[model samples]
Target: MTAALRATGVALEAASLIALRQVALRSRAEPVLAALPGGFATRRKGHGHEVADVREYVSGDDIRHLDKGTTARTGALHVRQFHEERDRVTLLVADFRSSMLWGISRAFRSVAAAEALALIGWQGVSEGGRVGLLALTPDGQVAVSPRGRVRGVLDVIGGLVRAHEQALQSVMAGTVADRSLDMAMSGLERLAPLGSEVIIASGFDDMGQGMEQRLAELARRRVPRLIRITDAAAGKLPKGRYPIRLSDGRRLRVSLSGHAQTQHETETICGRAALLIDAGSGVEQTARLLAANLPADRAP
Candidate 1:
């Protein structure tokens, strides 16, 4: 049992995630974190009342947007650019089923998922957006509503820690997995607003039925993204005998005869994901991957 515990990565405390706030703040100036997915890469441009920028007028510029004071002072037509005023809300959905408790490196898949969400949540908060969480654990679901600034990320971190600990306890007891990814997805509609940025982290262990259809429907109403956490051995294993630990803390040796390929339905369900991070990746690396896909010009 000691050896098994040592081999597997353990759960993370909420305090450990506090440093991610600094990482998120530092990433704001980094060039690697410049790109975001289509929805977040560009700000929503419109003729709304909220002024985003003021620049010298160009050909075909809207006459109504010409700044009279600026034009008269500079002797050149100046136009004001408007961006739609949107309430930036980021919703993080995490899956902590029994399957996510095991991994080959750095941390368990569940822990890695928590780290991923923390990084993203902090980034959202730093950008003047609200962050929330909906975690599906073996014990049940834990939900936190969207909130702005550090308070919001703190709430989400607390939820992640609570959900992960409960899942670890359930694994030790050999309990059945009750939560489903489908349920979490359905709950997004209720928890996330119409224009919310939804990010889901899961190993896709129990995605259940009709996931593709359900995801497509959710995408229509919200900007939903995904992070598929994985372990090294989950892909392909050499044909040989290997010792492994069961969720119930029992050790067992299993023999493999052929090369096994991991056949997950992640592509079918989460084709819109721009990031694919491994469970072995530490928090900083995970955060970097997420940062690379987030908009650099998020409003303060």
Candidate 2:
């Protein structure tokens, strides 16, 4: 590789690492007390022990939750209401396909996706919740079960870094795979428990058949988040001929002067997601968007 390409690679890696560290630090100051409340709201009522209120007993109210003292004093039946404590499992799914290997801006889409995953994992862990990862690489899928504390977050980050390195190597060797995002989503369905909060980060280039059905099923029981990693040049190639080098030491000239945009304008996953991340926006911008969208007690 040329010195310029190597330098760009290094810069991309460094930026991602910095973004991870910043997210970790910020999470310590303000924990995600609620399970992604705003966009990721589960809409399921809390079942915690903390009393929220009390009201007259309804026909369908749980008889066991009836307030005995209140019923006796008022000569009427009443039920105790408790505050809802959200489930604490956070799962991050990332795509590492060959398509992510290309970038027209500062760095590859894969790098940005990795950075976003790291940030979200760290943030979830800092809030005293268990975090896990499901990585879709050129070779196959890698799954990491959720774990509590900082160590779990570290493990997920390590996996992301390794996947990014592997993706770069695959691109160089012209050995990239054409895996679909649906495979990763299927893995998520099996691993993630009901009521878990899930965030999927990817370019979403290859969404296989029946993907909509899978997403809908997951959304019914879990809070879903989507991060769309894309290049600035996607669907907007300049009007000129350009020389492109292939991984097999071959150069090809391509013209885009009259090429109409062929990429899809929207993603099916967006319909089921509460939040979306545009990788072309850079780390800081993405982080800010997450902080704003995520449900937390204070600004992260």
List model 1 lDDT by residue over 150-189, tens digit each.
9999999999988877777777677744656786555668
Collision pairs in model 1: none
Winner by TM-score? 1
Model 2, position 105, has a per-residue lDDT of: 62
Query: What are the per-residue Cα lDDT tens digits for candidate 2 across 157-220?
Result: 7777666666666666667656567764566777787878778877777688766777778778
Prediction-by-prediction clash tally: 0, 1
State how far residue 47 of model 2 sits from its true place (Å).
14
Give residue 178's lDDT in candidate 2 (0 to 100). 61
What TM-score fits each model?
0.73, 0.67
